[model samples]
Target: MHKQLLLIGLLLLVLTVQGQNLWREGEMQVRVYVENQAQADFLKRSNMIGEPAGAFIRCYLTPDELLHIRQQGIRYEVEVDDLNKMSASMGSRGVPNGYYTVAQLHAIADSLEQNFPDICKVVHLGFATGMNELKAIKISDNVHLNENEAGILFDGGIHGDELGGPENLIRFARDLCYGYNNDAQITNLINNREIWIYYCVNPYGRKYMTRYNANGVDLNRDFGYMWNGEGNSSGPFSQPESKIYRNLMLNNQFVIHCSYHSGTEYISYPWSYRAQSTPDAQHHLMLAQMYSQSSGYTNLPYGQGYNGMYAINGSTKDFGYGALGSISWTIELSVSKQPPAAQIVPIYLKNKAAMLKMVEMAGYGIQGVVRDSITNLPIPALVFVNDFMCVTNNPVVGDFHKFLPGGSYTVKVVAAGHQTRVYENVVVQDNQATTLDVVLPRDTGRYAWRVISTHIAGNNPHDEGNTMGALGPPDNIRYSLGKNGYAIIDMCDTLKPGNGPEIKVFENDQTPENYMVMAGATPDGPWILMGHGTGNQEFELEPSGLQQARYLKIKDSGTGQSQIPDAGFDLDAISYVYRPATDTSGIIEGFTYIDWNVLIEKAPGTEIYYRDQVVYSDENAYFRFQADTGSFAMDAIWEMYGYANCPVHLSPQQHLYLNIIMEWMEPVETIAANNSITLYPNPGRDKVAIKSLTNNPLLSLLLCNAQGAVVHRIMNPQMNVDGEILLNVSTLKPGLYIVVGIDETGKSASGKLLIQ
Candidate 1:
């Protein structure tokens, strides 16, 4: 009898310990604060929102989101208890550890390493605005997982006001660590792909209880894809918080990005450029459906700006995917506020399972950014494109988007006052940056017939598109016809609409050169030239309407070194416009989300081109292109019945690395030589001086240095002269320079200036 009794006691002790361990695994150490108990009571009342159980009504609120409950004239804050916090019977610095304070939550960061311990590092991402070190413990077990993911970026709490996200992320991380050994799928994802997670993208915003970051900038809307800072200034790139993130994003090769946000429940993607249904709209919607089904979350009205929720600019999602070429999405957590610890824990557990699966479920594909052609700024707008057309409402907590199946695609970004920009056949074989910078013309395309802008400037006898007159970036110069040289130069700032009649290019006899000046109401100008011996000459009508009466220096393509002599009958007109039927360039007109096996080969470094621009491509033959910013279609210019046309298609999320093959063609090169002039030193190595006999004033001088910076200037911007204006390049370093001259009227001419 005594022996049996002792054995029973031993068995009971074992059961007691096992029971304690189970209790510990399911502990809910949380605290809530209210102005009084009234508001807390109200939250407690709503706590019965999701599901019900004993002891906890489910006040599903992260501290920040919980704070919102105060709208009823009440105040509140919430927190979760961690094991480390349970150890310090006394608060570390006024706050006890046995109780989870914000500090202890941070302390847990050191514990979680990468998915593959040997491959990545376990470290801190950055700090929040409150200066709280936002810590993360990445548990990378290469022995269990392989994480060379095309790239993955995940962040939470950009809107300090949206607190649930970060808190939920914490829960997600916690569950992953504790459940790793038991969870088979979780282990697989971590090991196979490289996943970067930043719990609390903007902690300062949360601590201060403000919607913006430390610098008062909306961290969510800072990338300059289609950025309009004055309208939506999150902060300058110089902000420490922003800089830290910017540095990471710019360097990250992650293919997909998921930013957590609250106040609404939805999975929005693409075409934030103008809040419109992109060519890939359906496709993106499909992916959102998948996320919704998997995560048990709701999808709200996405892609709507201030027009829907509020008209804002500089959103991270659009910028990340458009400018950086990363597929990005904004995951709005819950439709309701915070629940109690018991309620929150289960919800968190559920969400963790859902999101981990969602990330895994979001497949691969091509993604990129849509920036202002001139400013290189990110614009907050909807995006659309073809190949595997996709449209996602991406939130910018950090990374761009998920991995791709290694392929190519065409992307289009649209917004007001900008041209219908298109990128044809962009390829993404691996993690490569396809900095597809898009140029948007001012919004009046309706009053605007067309935009014939170019990185290339038309003739003054140098190359295909331009002379020294229209030098590209690194230098912002505008040019026109001038004396002693084919093109005259001017400053960018000083040259605006109707600001010309400033530059003069006259004949050797001081006679206003025989030139007929033609101006357009918009960029797609019906240009009229007044000179002789005209031949092949390229021209670009600005995408935006022309500042009245702008002029360009047009000298003959020149058969010889001498300026083409006028045969007296020298006046012709030419006009180029968008193929006026479908209001587009080319469209993807197909499905996105391709399978890798369909790809020709998993190579890298291939290229996609539209007209003369190399827009997209990868090593393998995977790529797509865009034509309409309004539609996600690309410029796959196909001609029929003497007119060129392109169709528009939309994309969906989860349908990444699309195998959507596009069909496109080139329009026969057409240049109507209205009228031409003359120039000397045709290919002059040292100083190929010029003398234009055209009668147009210089408006702007677009010049570029060897490093692509504008080096010289001739302010008036008019070439109503016929003499020599030596370009004093003694200050210019020895290298190739593109010198340009624009008349006060906006006529341009460019040439190559070499320095030995």
Candidate 2:
């Protein structure tokens, strides 16, 4: 009794000094580093507040503190790591011991496939950079997984060194397949859903015991979805781990792809697209809420990106929903799950139950493809869902992807700048799939600009309020043209502070005196500083007169023109001459993309006509007009009279092509008298053609169609030469058009010839 009181008094003293850092009912566990014995005692007491039996305290202590405890021989339950102890704890029968090596993992996956003939198969998703073999075990029972009610995909070992996730994942699979017939809940979960177990999404990382894959690319960050800012795994499937999993996940209709990572213990949902609320955020929140209730894990909405703890801006979850349309999440497996591994079985087991319940929870589905609308050619477009509540946003790319629950989603596309498009009401049905094919328009337009040089913000200078402001540009317009390739902004004129970022300008064709000039990054050159940070820290460059360029590149110069470069640079935004407004006021809504800098190779002659309709082109290489009929798209053989099959595609990236295929045109009617017909050059050279009376007056003409409709006409005076006439067939697309003519005698004659 006296000892108990002393211990209780000590705990109270600890509590008095250290605030209440206890695990409330269902609260997640994060390691705590107390300052003193009192604080440690308080933490020790609160660690058991709502913790059930068999739980332990794992302190992340300083070397000094560890020494103090060890030297004094203090009696307390705490530890750092016990690799062997963790490896020894086994699950149900048929469940092999956990391992830490890549070879061991492969062997285990292979054995599981062979042992469980009814429900699992080992598949080689892809090979690694070092030519190392990478594979996974797909555990299922329904021979072919035919029409299961739901799909639950579990991917682990994204952060390679985080071995806890792999262990839990293997255990879950073992429990599901092995425990199905034996355990009721397990049986039910397996029967209702095709729970896909994808252990070691980043096998190469796991093999090396590193956090990133062999490519030095973080596996969890490789998804091609939600790819702006710090989003996506180092460049889509660039890492072996992310590649195989991406291929696997995109092919399957998963309701929930609950991936695992260690270091922190939290069940976080989507919106990794950017650090803001997405259109499907409510759904994610609801899932988070459900997760909290189902798993009884404290939910923290802070930094979610591997970059930090805050729910990231562009992540797998972001692309999952924004790109593939799957409700995905990054479930941080705790480093707090102690050793003597058996102590964690319950945690993994409980999560298994929670995951099973989540599978049954409501989920929205999404499906899509990127293809050239005209030629039906598939081109990759960066895609994403824009949430109204965001400071910044970017697009997701690649083929099909997935996210959390679905609902009304707005898909915004940004590729070769062919008029950024948006698809609203991209509705997603629950427990089902929605297919969307994104058609990329051809590029051809005026004022169609690409990024030029990047320097300091133009607004950096002025009578503005900035004291220590030396990095940003001065004045409003100091855009000077240098013989070399930098659009030198004159900031010494009207400089100030509290401005925007550093920027620069250049023409796409100008060869930089130094491609490595101002653009110096950590790795190397060809760097260009765009926009970055807030108004106070970034460099801002003003637009020069007629900003005529396609690709101007710039990099951060240690010049007093912009923000302090952290790590590599402060490049945060890209500026081009795109209609910066959603609501555009124009004669034609079809926007144009042009490189005023790229000199035109062709000179304009008289109005070029196609099918007798005058087609116009601007100074730049772009043409625009509106049409009521005809399905427009990109890439096709434009058969006009004599241009020798000109291959035409859209610029600014093409939108809709209203091609007039005279041959495919539906037969209508014709007026032949003054509307009669005439043919140019009696028996012409390349094209033997005829014209409607709409062409000349001297020679009369007539025509008929399969529908008995007079299709053409021509007159006499409109002709010249050897008593015949020269037929202006240059504008006629290769096809048939009737020609009838009458003389002073009022008698009509008709002739027919095919034009190539």
Tens digit of lDDT per residue, candidate 2, span 711-748?
A: 44444435444344555555555543335455554334
Q: CA lDDT of each candidate?
A: 0.40, 0.42
Write candidate 1's Cα lDDT for 1-756 as tens digits. 699998887687556533432112323323333434464345433421111111122233334434455456543223344322332232323222122335545655544443324433445556554345665444444422212233466777776645566677666666666656577886666554456667666665554344455455566545443333421353324245554665465545445667777554555565443434433445445555555666644433444232132223345665555434455667766644333334445555546655775556443444344433322233333344453322322211111233344456666554433565667777765433343434464442211111112111111222111122132111221222222123211111111222112222222222223333234332223443432322222232222244333333333232332222331212122212222122233333232222233442222332332222344344344455544323222322112101112223433221223343332211222111121222223222344344332346544454465223454556754333445443444455665555555544433444444454
lDDT of 1 at 567: 19
Q: Pick the candidate with the highest TM-score.
A: 2
lDDT at residue 135 of model 1 (Cα atoms): 52
lDDT of 2: 0.42
lDDT at residue 72 of model 1 (Cα atoms): 67
lDDT of 1 at 266: 56
504: Cα error in model 1, Å? 24
Q: What is the lDDT, from 0 to 100, of the residue 677 in candidate 2? A: 38
